[model samples]
Target: MGREFIEIFEEWAKDYDESVAGQDPQYAAVFANYEGILNEVTARSTGTVLEFGVGTGNLSEKLLQAGLDVIGIEPSQAMLDIAKEKHPELTVLEGDFLTYPVSDTPVNTIVSTYAFHHLTDDEKAIAVKQFKEILKENGKIVFGDTMFASEIEKQAMIDSAKEKGFSALAEDLQREYYPIIDTLEDIFTTNGFDIEFKQMNHFVWIITAIKNKE
Candidate 1:
C-alpha cells in the first residue's frame, strides 16, 4: 500500500532516530516534541494494539514499557530490522496500512505515529474501512501524524517551507498525502467511528477514532 516510499525508509532506517530528535533541521518542526508525540499516542492506546508503520520501534518500546501487548507492522525490511534490533522481543511483521495479519486475540486499539501520510486520501478511507471490520466495537485508532486544517493551510505550509529554503520539506509536503482534517473527519465518521482531533504540534495532530458500530 505504502511501498512506494520503501526505498526512502530503507535509506532512512538508520538515521530515523536522529531525524526525529531534531538533528535534521529540514524536519525539526515536523518532528518537534518527537518523544512527547510518541508518549501521547502510547497513553491513548489500550490492550492488544496493532501498530502500523513501527519505524525503529520507538513507539513500540513505549507501548511495551506501558505494559501493552503490541504487534508492529512495517513495509520496509530495513526499518523492521532496526526495530527488531532495538527490541529483540518486539512482535513485528512485514505489512502496511492496507495489508497485515491479525491474531486470534481481538485488537482493542490501533496506534500509529508520523506514518499515515504515506497513503493517499482514497487509500486512507479504504484503510479505515478495513480497520473497522477488524476491530472490536469501541476499539480505538490513535494516530499522531502531520495533517492540515484546510487546503489553504496545507498550501500555506508548503509556501512557508519553501520560503524558509526547506525545499526538501516543501517537496515532501507536496509528494506525500498529508491529509486535511475535514477529509479525515469524513472518512472516520462515514466508516462508523466517533472521532476527535487534538493538535500535538505545528505539523502533527493526534487523531483518536473509536469504532462505534459494527
Candidate 2:
C-alpha cells in the first residue's frame, strides 16, 4: 500500500501542496482538518519532531511553526527535495518509513498526517514498535489520516456507494484496506501504548498515542 503511493507521489510532488487543498471544498476541508489535528496534539510540546512521510513538507512546515525541531522522513527524493527547498533548516531524510533509522538523539514527538494510512495493518504494528524505540520516555505519536472502524462499516460504506451507482468508486474502495479505528486501538494497546481515537466529519480519523509511560 505504501509503495503504491510512492510512485505516484514522485510525479505529483511538485504541485502536491496546492492540489491537495485547492481541488474542492471537501478536499480543502480535509487538508485543514489534518493541519489542525497535528497542531492541536503537538501544541504544548517543545521538542524534536520525527515526521514520517513528510510529503512536500505540508505538515512539517506546520510543526516548524509550532516551534519544534523537525526531522522529516520521506521515501520519494523528489518530494524530499521540495521539502528541503521549502525549509532548508529541516533535517529531511530520504528513506522508507519502515526502514529509516532515526538519529541517536531521541525524538520528543512523532507525527504523520494523511500519510501513515499507506501502511497495511500489520506494517503499522511493526512501525509502532520501531517508533517506541526512537521516542523518549512519555513520548507521543499523533496521527491524522483516512480510516474506518470495522468491516461492517467498511462494507456498508462501500455498499452505499455501489447502490448509488458509484461502482468505480466502490471498486477502488474495495481494493484499499484502510485501518479500522477499533482495530487501531487494540494494536496500540497491545503494543503498550495508551491511545485516543476520534472520527472527524465521519471520514477522517485522528489518533494520539503515548508510548509506555508506565
Candidate 3:
C-alpha cells in the first residue's frame, strides 16, 4: 500500500483540486506562506525559479504573477495537464525529482509547497543533495508541509482525521511514505542547507533554507 500510493495519487489527479476546492483555504494559506518566504529570500524578482512537484499550477501561478521566470516539474501528467492549462506561460515538465533533468541554467531559487513530505528518507537525502547541486551559489530553498511535534501529536492528527469524517486522511496517508520534519532537518543540514526560518501552524510547518555561500 505504501509503494502504490503514488499510483493512487496519479489517478486522483483528475478531480483532486475539485474535490478539495471548497475545503482547501487553510492549505492555500500554507502556500501563501511559502510565497512570503520566497519574497524574503530573494531580492531579485526576475530570476529563474524551479518548483518541484508543482501540482495544478497553484504556486507556479503566484510566482509568475510576481514576475519571476518559473519552471515546474511534476511527475503526474494529469496534474501537469491542469497546471499547463492554468499557467501556460510557465514552462512545465513531466518528471520526477529523483531523475528529472534539471535546467542547464543555474537556478536562482528553488521552492516547493507541500511536496517534499512525499520523499522517503533515502529519497529525501538524494533530493537535498540534488537541490544543492542545481542551485546557484546564493540560491535559496523554501518548502512548506505538515510537521508533527511528537509521536503523541502524530497520533492526535490521526484521531482528528477520523473525527473529521476522513477529510484529509487521503493526504495524510500519502505523507506516510516520506520523512517528516525531525528527520527532514537533518537531511537539509547534511546536504549543505543552512536553516533560515521555520514556523508552525496547527499541524503544518513552513521552512526556508539557504545554500551556504562561501
Candidate 4:
C-alpha cells in the first residue's frame, strides 16, 4: 500500500492542485485550517524554510507570499515540474524527504502538508529524525495531514467524499494511511521535538512541533 500510494500521488501530481481546487467545501476547509496553522507558527519569520513533498507548490506559494525564503523537496518530477512552473523563482528539488539534500547550517523551520502519511513506518521515523537533524536548535516543524478519527466522524468524511465523487482515492487513503497520527507523534517526540499544538478537523489532524534544545 505504501509503494502504491507513492505511485498514485506521483501520477496525480500533474493535476493535483486543480483536483484539490475543485474539492468539496469540507475538504477545502482543511486547506484553510492549514493556513491558520502556518500563520500561528510562522508569525515572525526567521531564516530559511524547507518544505517536504511540496506537490504543485500550493503551500509553497503561500509561504512565498508571506515573504519567507523557501525551498521545496519533492520526489515526483511531475509534481516538481508543476511547482517550478507555478513558482519559477523558488527553488524546487527532486528528492525523497528522508534523503533530500539539506543545508549544513540547518533551516529555521520545516513544514509539510498532507505528505508525511504517505511514508512507511520506518520512512516516517527517518523523516522525523532527518527533520530534527536539519533544524536549528530553536527551530520548529508544522504539518497537516489525515489521522484516525472517531468511527462516526471518519464515516461522515467518507460519506461526504463519496457524495462529492472523491470516494475512490479517499477510501484508498483511509484504508492505507489513516492511523499513523499516534506513531507520528511518537516519532517526533522520540527525536527531540515537542508536539506543541494539535487539532482534529474532520478526518485530518493538524500539528506543530518545536525542536527541543539541549
TM-score of each: 0.97, 0.85, 0.81, 0.81
Ranking by TM-score: 1, 2, 3, 4
Off by over 4 Å in 3: 1-4, 24-46, 167-171
Clashing pairs in 4: none
Worst 10 residues of 3 by lDDT: 37-46
Poorest lDDT segment (10 consecutive residues) of candidate 4: 37-46
Candidate 4 all-Cα RMSD: 3.3
**Residue-pair clashes, model 1:** 0
Q: Which candidate do you rate higher for lDDT, 2 or 3?
A: 2
Q: Write the per-residue lDDT of candidate 4 for residues 161-188, one digit (tens) a residue.
A: 7778875656755665554466677888
Clashes of 4: 0
Local accuracy of candidate 1 as per-residue lDDT tens digits, 53-117: 99899999999999998899999999999999999999999899998988666699999998999
Judge candidate 1 at residue 206 and give its lDDT.
97
Tens-place lDDT per residue, model 3, 1-214, is 1233567557867766654353454244333444454444333333788888787777777788778888888887778888888877879886766767775778988877667767677877887788888889978877666666555667776676666666566356444653456677788888878874465445456577778875
Best by lDDT: 1
> Measured by TM-score, how close is model 2 to the native structure?
0.85
lDDT of each: 0.93, 0.76, 0.68, 0.72
Candidate 1: Cα lDDT at 13: 91
State which candidate, 1 or 3, has the greater lDDT.
1
